[model samples]
Target: MTRPSNDSLNAAWDLIDHSQLILVVMHTNPDGDALGSGIALTLGLRQQGKEAHLVCPQPTPLIYEFLNPGDIVEPEAPAGVPDLAVVVDCDRADRVGALQGLVNQARRVLVVDHHPPTSDFGDVRLSHDGYAATAEVVHYLLAHRSVPVTGRMAEALMTGLITDTGGFRFSNTRPETLEMAASLARAGASVADISRRVYDSRTLAGLKLLARALASLQSSPAGTVAWARLSADDFAETGAAPEDTEGFVNVVHSLRGADVAALLREEQPGVVRISLRSRGAAVVSQAAEALGGGGHALAAACVLEASLDDAEERLLQELRKWTAF
Candidate 1:
């Protein structure tokens, strides 16, 4: 695995040493990479006798409740202003949602992420898109600092690695990723248990939601683009929260002729969440960036402030502009 630069690693450690109270914030929706990095950092800092608090804009997804990191709190600012804020797995500060205010209160901001930065907000930005997951970067940082990776920390980091790589099946997975997984396993991370809880176990309601989403699947005329929609009604009927629809977008990529896939979810009345995926050289991040969202080349997302139908039409227009087929 490529190592983090010594300058960046030393600078981050210096900031941590000079700070007493630290705030760690993840993105609004709080995916596995986001949670894994934030929680692991929180635990690591606290282990060093520093006061570290983890903030998530939304509640932890039911599937990830196995993490049970007690330090996670709502977006509200803590008792005292934090000396340092660590933003993980988020490309932009605004992605922290309401917690941006709390982060702004910190004296210094350190951004450790794997996505391309949309803006220069953090005081110290340690971003490397080459890494498969932000947790890998975090693991590197901790290892360099000589922080012992506890069993819990290993599990959390492994969760981020597995989830971000689609269980090591995505194109981003590399030899280094597997190497990290093997090290984490040796440190007592249960690959089987974490995989089962994250990918295998699903609530009955989630399954119903998945069925409804699949039922709405559609393809473009040339069959190069496949898409699906999940309406607010579907969520209400199935009694599934938005988090339960995590991997539903991958279903579109299963189609034989599909080079691009999208999943549009209408979680609120005038708001649509768009998740895009592409194969080979097709770049879905470009489409997401056009819509004021960003992610990796193959997987990206955006939010549209329109009705589901209008969002669908707009996204289709955008996808057609880049899709080869």
Candidate 2:
């Protein structure tokens, strides 16, 4: 993994130190990485006596209720404009959703992300795709600036590392990743507790949603591609929120002969959300970008303005262009 340059790290520190009220923003529909990194940074800044706030465009998912760092409010135009806005775990400005306008109002923007940037917007961009999670990058940044990593910060950072690596099972798991996990563990992060809460804990509604998604699973003729669809009715019948679909795509991605997996869900009446996953060889981000979405190479997502069936067909065609099957 490429290391963050000292120049960028120093610049980020200068920006943070000079700023009194800092606003930390994460992407909409935040996953573990986005929430973890954002919360960790906010807490760290507050510990340093800075007025830092973490804001999201959507509510935090129930699954992450355990790592509550307090006061993660929904995005709004602040009463006093912040000196610096730090956007975390988002590849593009649009990913910030409604928060983009508020972020733009800041005097300066600093983007802290692990995904490759889709556009240039931030005044100080500290992004490197080599890191497995944005939390890892944030950890490095804090360490470089000599900020103490508190137990709570360690737990939040560990959550990002564990969730993004799929419990250290994904190909992104490197020696440095494990070493960082070990450091967080030494700093009071509980691996067993985190894994249990994140991966094992699921509500009945979530299980029902997963069952429905698996029941609708299909595959290509050559068995190289596996796909599934869940309509809005499935969400209504199961009483599951959109966040309940988290990690559901992994089920199809684990198929024996499947090199690529796609999950199409009707997030709203006329809006379909498509998630794509691969076994590392296939660059699924290309397909996601083609559909006006963006993410990592192995895991990506896109939302389409079409019915579930139409979105599935369109995604399958895009997947075919990238995968052999």
lDDT (Cα atoms) of all candidates against the true structure? 0.88, 0.88
Candidate 2 per-residue lDDT, tens place, 141-254, comes to: 998977888898899999999999999999888788899899999999998999998989888998999999999999988898899899999999999988888888998988
Check candidate 2 and list the clashing pairs: none
RMSD list, candidates in order? 1.6, 1.4
User: Model 1 over residues 1-325: C-alpha lDDT tens digits?
Assistant: 3768999999999999999999999988788888888888889999888999887756788788888854455555579989999999988888888888888999999999998667888988888888999999999889888899999889899999989998999888878889999999999998899999999887899999999988999988888889999999999999998888888888778888898999999989889999998876589999998987788888999999999999999998898888864
Candidate 1, residue 196: lDDT: 94
| TM-scores for the candidates | 0.95, 0.96
TM-score for model 2? 0.96
lDDT of candidate model 1 versus the reference = 0.88
Candidate 2 deviant stretches above 4 angstroms: 69-77
